[model samples]
Target: MADSAESAAVPIISTSTSTSIANVAASPAEDEAIPVQRKSSSPVTDPGTSPGQAAPINSAHEQSEQEDSDDDSALGAGSILSETTSLADEITQYRYEHNRRYHAYKDGEYWGPNDDKQNNQLDIAHHLYLLTLEGRLHLAPIGDNPQNVLDVGTGTGIWAIDFADQYPSAQVIGFDLSPIQPMWVAPNVRFEINDACDPDWGYKKNSFDFIHVRAMYGSVADWPAFYRQALAHLAPGGWFQQIEMSVVPTSDDGTVTEGSIFDMWGKISLEAGDKFGKDLRIHEQIKGYLDDAGFEEVVEKVYKWPIGPWDEDIHMKQIGLWNQLHWEEGIEGWSLALLTRVLGWSYTEVQAYLGKMRTGIRDRKVHAYHIINVVYGRKPIPS
Candidate 1:
């Protein structure tokens, strides 16, 4: 793992006209930018590939095996048979609106959905993040053998499973409001259903060696309190890392004009988030929150994530292709609930607005991109 100072010293590509992306400073005046480093693009496989088939159940009794096979055949393809407890039924009792599914546990708290479509989009987003980070799972420098790791808002539990596989010694816990994670997972990893924004996390203090949060922009109402809770849960000298993308799209060349669909989408979404009490502009404020939470050695890295495959840079172009698919598939899930509930727009109205937004997302001429912010900090050890 790269040390904090070394990671900070490495320069990233800047989205602005300027050459380099900089580490955010304590104050705007103290900020410094570094030169951008261009990397050669590599081939990226499709993340949507189908998984291999599961092994057939083995039974000593032929009659038992025959019965099980009959039951499985009765359910048809793409179905599973499992005994469910009352609690399981309640957890899976998803609320449907505008043809999207929201979490039943914290029904209205989160803005996005937990349906199969949205889950696939989340996986695509996970792949985009991996590409953005040049195939690294995280940029926190958490070292080679972090003992206990926590993944907050672990949508599909993809990141947690991957991390557990990479570090077999680590005990990884991924918690979310929805119980959508697969039952089969790494031995060192487990999934829990919990509302992370709640005051009490139910975990003992100083429990985690590393805590990771990703794409939780509009989900967290109070970021300072969230950071404080993370700090409290992290062991001394442990790290807290967060990855968020700006909701607003920007262009270095001014191709994205004011009053355009892209611009309107951003303004209206941010407005809806404000009315909902969870600010969508968390990307711009996380660094300050980390510093305010008493974390030391705080570091921030920002990346330019293109919305479409319009970039001249080969690396960015590949990321843009995946990101374009992410936006295309995710717009409905991202917009429906927030706009209808908070902004008081009708379902039809939201759909109409999103229709135009989809066109804007696919317009390569716009050359729009969202800023991806990665901020991390370490809890200070006692003097």
Candidate 2:
């Protein structure tokens, strides 16, 4: 990874751009691998909408149905399609025939098995290496001479690199679905391209002092199995941290406007998950899974992030901006995966419906906001 690249699509970090991009500074390793911010290739593509208005998935009955089921289960029989080596080989064949398409791999564009991101968004998001720095969130209690950390779903390999730099004696490993991680990492920091969800991946049990996962909202259909695997593999006194979002649905004063924007968002996003066997409600049930897996000292911190630059406070305002960008980009990103690909909807139709969603978010009468929640736990010292 380079320190920077010419600004490409969605350069949120550029001063020339209208928005601010969150960047974290680490060590020399970071300058090369973790903190390198760059532009993404390929402009956001427009997915089309339904030519005729169809009955949207009914939310009234869906809510009742959602209340009765537990989304957690052990990994059952499944194919290894998600972790296939050559995305172009299988994914291209599948998408060309099935209308499935992934964003071009230029900078940090890997979703499942594609390697792209030369940028370092993943590193800054973790911010775990900044524990010693003033005012940054880092999971501690690694003991005085801690070493050996593992980051699951390490998007850009930033977290692992920074952690290795912070603990010079520690060996850090980061794993993801693609080979996008930079080839040159810290001497102690290594990157592996593998699906963490795979049950048979070769790894010694009870290793690693810390394990981290973030933003796995819909990508993980079975979180319980995911958590169970973490518990089973975690060494004594190991820690696991998970961060997720509320999927952009909230009620201000508990009175939703008629035809509120977020109502449309909730319908589309959740229904998209429904069609794909993904779980948007995974955030709500994390605590249950952690406790059931026999983990101790479980902690859950939920933050109600503003939707846009609405709040009077400046920090809250920026968070609102991040929220807005996340919402807009998220719709485009997921549509490429779910609606256009899995749902087999036309690109034009998805674009038009998304425009309606954007309109809803801009409407103040809608009175909606969303939140990001984080949950973490530690394995007790073995008896």
Candidate 3:
């Protein structure tokens, strides 16, 4: 496994383009694989919305229904703030669909499932991230003694639990839409049920010493508001870190041909995110959001994460193998709701497409990889 010391020694390719591009750093032999960098400072627009097209105006009845849905959901900010325990029958009343279990509290809000299979996948992804960061849990410069830590969208509570174990003195709180985390946890760590998109997080302002958000690409509809909320709860001089991955895959060697299942998966997933109102391409806009949210000393790191065990670098090869399992276990859960609910695809259609996509993902010759973005910034202390 690669350590942080080794990772720091590797050179990183930097670019100012608005599109998702590979930032993989390689040795002299692999220089030919690097593409010419593009220069641009323009912001990326929502792929779901076209240029010059007016936003959809809902009718009075539709608007009322939407409002009602948000208010009645058990995971709504208002209800979550009032509820004492997440173990209520209503909170655990999971909805079943296509052999998977989803959170009933905020049904249809998040595309992923909360079942054991999906939870296992989430754990695998957690390990993959650790390896990608070279065994470092986070990139933020939050010193060795962070007091109050918040893990937003902490699926499986694995990351938070690990952090609590690492820093025994720190208090760690992990919140997610589902209460699927284990009851047995570290003394300083606890899990809660809440949605990050909620207007109020029910936490005091400027209380958290460190806030960590991971893999929240499609769960948030409003990026700017979400960042502001994260910023609000963070103490001045505290650090806020978010790690997100691009759904689109690219190959340094052109093995990922155009119009393939891999290609279609990326394109369709982006389309579904657009329809769902959450941008799947959040990795491309996180830096700007942090800057606009008033975070200071912001930093962004980009890495190319392989999908299979195809890379020559031993560390990357191991990470790729784990990533392959991630896609395999995660594809069904990731696809079912997004394709059927948002894109209007039938269950049968989604299954067939996933079959092909899974095969493509396992193809070692393809050398396909996704871009993982790690962005962190500090909330400036009062002047």
Candidate 4:
């Protein structure tokens, strides 16, 4: 992993609007922009009427409304692009191997991509998480207005920002390896660069009211040790929740063939993660880890996340669409380092394999879904 101090101090670099396409939410009439490097566009200049000419009231009102709408639309896209640029700036000084641009941080450290594609995928996955959780930020029983919260592995810092917005009384800190969080965040929400696996988290003992971690599968080298550290830092009665997606896809109708590309992807991903001392399938063992770490009132909620718009339920179908898009957009970024660097496959071979896997992911007939596991536990109060 990158040095946490250096990552935090890096300046935010400027990026063009072209990179903002993946961040924007559009109406039916709007067009989606493709993700590509390009020069920043000039600001939209106002076409003011001539000095002597008075604009019509109706046209003026319409223009004002249009401008407001434009600003609103641009805010989300701007934040997303800004966060990506900041993260890129932080890690650009690091050594990257191969034409694939994979970071060579600690040997056998995080193998995930930190570029635009991965950032966009993080945003999309956040959307899907909201949808799956029925618009709830988390399933933890964090209680109302918890004073202090920490989001471990807070990619893109979207959850931390939203949580801060939801509970203004609480201070939310998003900790991550890369400085991928936006510069413009809520007063209560801030991003820090740190490794969760670091035994000495540098926080006061029993300080945090709540701690949240999500989509961190295959990131940490030690699961039990990490939970123990969380337990140590959490206040008595504080809550710790972990959310992870099972990398292995399952099918309800048995349409996903046993030896298909989906299975192959999961197998290869698991092997790669194991090689790095992090297992992508670690979600399966979270409950055990929490139990072993002496957490109390442990609870687990599992949700099936369909890969395509194949679900019979309307809500599930919409979720599947988002998941499908996220999977498709992320396949390349997710596979490149794992396949080429760790798994000893050529870049071309990895791309070819991902292409096949993506086809399976998009096939609605497959009815494929991954299990999303959410487990939370509380620190017992001292007797």
Candidate 4: give the clashing pairs.
none
Candidate 2 has a TM-score of: 0.67
- Name the top TM-score candidate: 3
| Predicted structure 1: lDDT | 0.76
Candidate order (TM-score): 3, 1, 4, 2
1-383 per-residue lDDT for model 3 (tens digits): 12222232131433333231123333212212212122111223442453443223232344565779866665667666556455476688899998899998877789999998888888777766766665677879899988888999998888887787677557788989999887766456778878899987767678889999999999999999999999998989999999999899888677888998888889999999999998899998999999998999988888877787677666566567677777888899988999998889999999899889888987877888888888999999998
Over 145-253, each residue of candidate 1 has an lDDT whose tens digit, in order, gives 8888899999888888878777765778888999888776645677887887889777767878999999998998888899999999999999999999999987877
Ranking by lDDT: 3, 1, 4, 2
TM-score against native, each model: 0.79, 0.67, 0.79, 0.76
Better of 1 and 3 by lDDT: 3
Best by lDDT: 3
* Stretches > 4 Å off in candidate 3: 1-87
Looking at candidate 1, the ten consecutive residues that score lowest on lDDT are 24-33
In candidate 2 the C-alpha lDDT for residue 368 amounts to 58
- The lDDT per prediction is 0.76, 0.55, 0.78, 0.71
| Candidate 2 lDDT, 1-383, residue by residue in tens | 01223222221122223233334332232112223353221122221342332222222234444564364223232523444445545323322212333323231123332323222333333432231112233434566555667778776665566566566556667776655566655456667655655664345567767777776777766677888888876788898887776674776555345456566667677887777777777777787899998889887755555555455444444444444544554555545456665567787887788898777655544445665556778988978
